[model samples]
Target: MIHSALEFLTQELNSFIKLKVGDPITNRVVLSSVTNEQGIAIPDQSLGLSLINIEEERTSKDQQNRFINAVGKVEKRNPDIQLNLYVLITANFQNRLPNNSSDDYVEGLKQLSYAVAFFQSKSVFTQENSPSLAGFDGDLKKIFVELYSYSFEQLYNFWSVVGAKYLPSVLYKVRTIRVQENAIQQSGDPIEKIYLESRHKP
Candidate 1:
């Protein structure tokens, strides 16, 4: 589910960016890590969407293990785990052109701004609004995106930990992707009564 959600986001953003720019760049946005295992930059002249962190959404934690099925049988399953994902959108562009050296840098910022605009226009995504999401086989109904800000020190620490130089980037918090197992732990008939009558005197 996590992978599906991120992939969906990357595709949608790429489409929007292409529509705005019309630069004939195939896959201007992609789901990728900023650096590889060797700590080398992986993407250039493109927007990289990377999962930076995952935090459980404790408030939505399910406590009930039992639920009634459509056939009226009681079934027990473990509580689902809800998670919020922190993703980083980074733009990597270099001065590759001798005549238009600044074009890459300027285009990087342009692409990044379009990304922010796309999210701002629509912060929430649902199957109704985003029909492409229906292609994924799951009950992931909706997702919310919000801008996440960081202090200067926090940003420095993050870049240091990732072993990469800072580029034009933005952080967003994606809310509430659910993880659940389909297997039922237990099953039983529904309880109809709490007590039974004693007919004889003790």
Candidate 2:
């Protein structure tokens, strides 16, 4: 196998997953993406790649940069294949109060999405830090913690309300990569393929 073998091992992995792991639900395998294993291919690290470089409850840009730096370190260690990263953060982190304005709320979400696209292979997830644009689920007094059991749920609802008030055009951008030339040209596609015919049965 070539040094850049993982660059095209999706086909092999697809068959393996079908036989061993079954179809994945939340995240899908990036067809053109691969890792640095010798003859065998590896799955994208989503199963293992989790929320890392997380700060002690901070959501400032500085904290975001810290995670970006972590991604850089992973790249240096695995130069042959790029590492997939997903930065996880909550909106309205308990510590920092976001600017009070509908526009600011929308702007923040747009910024985070842009950051994800720019940080390819390195995406960020924000489930906790959503700004409560519509105000606390009902006044901050009522028998709370009942309807919204967790703060996370409240945050989710908050962002939902904000989006309803004014949705931002935060389009997600996906990139496609190809091999300049496969080292195993004689071996056919780095990924394997199933055969087909007209028709057949017992």
Candidate 3:
């Protein structure tokens, strides 16, 4: 489900970028880390989508009850695991512009702005909005996307840890991805009622 969700987001964003940029610029949107181990540039001017963090949704408990089988027995099942995924989308453009102009920097900022606007306009992704997610094997229902802000110190530390220089990027949190198998673990007979009887002697 996580993989499918991220893939769907990348595909949707790429489609939007293509429509906005036109044929002159090739579709460079990719699901890849902003930097490689060797500290080399990521080939071309591309928008990189990377999974930076994942956190379990801890506010709510998995309170789904056991399932009832055809024979009226209670079937024990594992609770669902809900998660939120944090993704970093970075625009990696060239550092130097031709003719000594700031075209490269400007382009990077522009791409980042477009990315933000794209999410702002449409933050919710569901079967109705994204058909690709709909085709997933009943794992995904809907995903809400929101911008996640980072403090300056946190951002600097993150970049240092990743061993990459800061680029024009945006952080987004994808909420409420559920993972459940619904497999019965154990079965037990249902208790119908409790009876209390007493005998009194005169």
Candidate 4:
């Protein structure tokens, strides 16, 4: 489920970028960490979508208990896991110009801005909104995307931990990814009826 959800998001974003930026940008968007094993740079002028954080939805914990089937049989099942994913999109642009670094910086920023705008315009993915996501075989019924804000200190710490220099980037929270297995652990017979009797002595 997680893989399908991420793939759907990446494909949607790539399509949007291509439509907005045209064919000039040859680099395709990728789902990867911002840094390599040797702490080197990512691909040039490519949008990197990295999963930075994951959190379970505590509000959905009510379904952890056993459920009763339609035939009144008691069935034990595992709790459904609902998750939220925090994805970071970074625009990695190359500084082809030897002396001037501002051009590269500007290009990266421009790509980031485009990404931000794209998400803002389409904050929700559903059957009506995104056909690709809707057609997915997994349990991805809907996805809500919103820009996640971080303090400057937190942002700096994140980049430092990721072992990468700061690049033009945006953080988005994808919400309500559900995972469930329908395996019944146990079952019990249904109660058919109750008997009552009253007696009086003369």
**lDDT (CA) for every model shown?**
0.87, 0.26, 0.82, 0.81
Give me the displacement of residue 47 in model 4, in angstroms.
0.9
Q: Name model 3 segments beyond 4 Å from true.
A: 69-73, 96-103, 192-202
In model 3, what is the error at residue 185, expressed in angstroms?
Answer: 1.6
Give lDDT for model 2.
Answer: 0.26
TM-score of each: 0.91, 0.17, 0.86, 0.84
Model 4 spans > 4 angstroms off: 24-27, 68-74, 96-103, 192-202
Question: Can you write out model 2's per-residue Cα lDDT over 21-44, one digit (the tens) per residue?
Answer: 355543222322111234112131
| Top candidate by TM-score | 1
Against the correct fold, how does model 4 do in TM-score? Answer: 0.84
Candidate 4, 19-137: lDDT as tens digits: 87786455457888778787634577677888889999897565665788998888988988889999999887768657766338787787778788888899988866677886664
Count of backbone clashes, every candidate in sequence: 0, 10, 0, 0
Q: Which candidate is the best by lDDT?
A: 1
On residues 81-158, what C-alpha lDDT tens digit does candidate 1 reach at each position? 899999999988776666775348888898899999999999999999998887873577899999999999999999
Winner of 3 and 4 under lDDT:
3
Alpha-carbon deviation at 177 in model 3, angstroms: 0.8
* Candidate 1 similarity to native, TM-score: 0.91
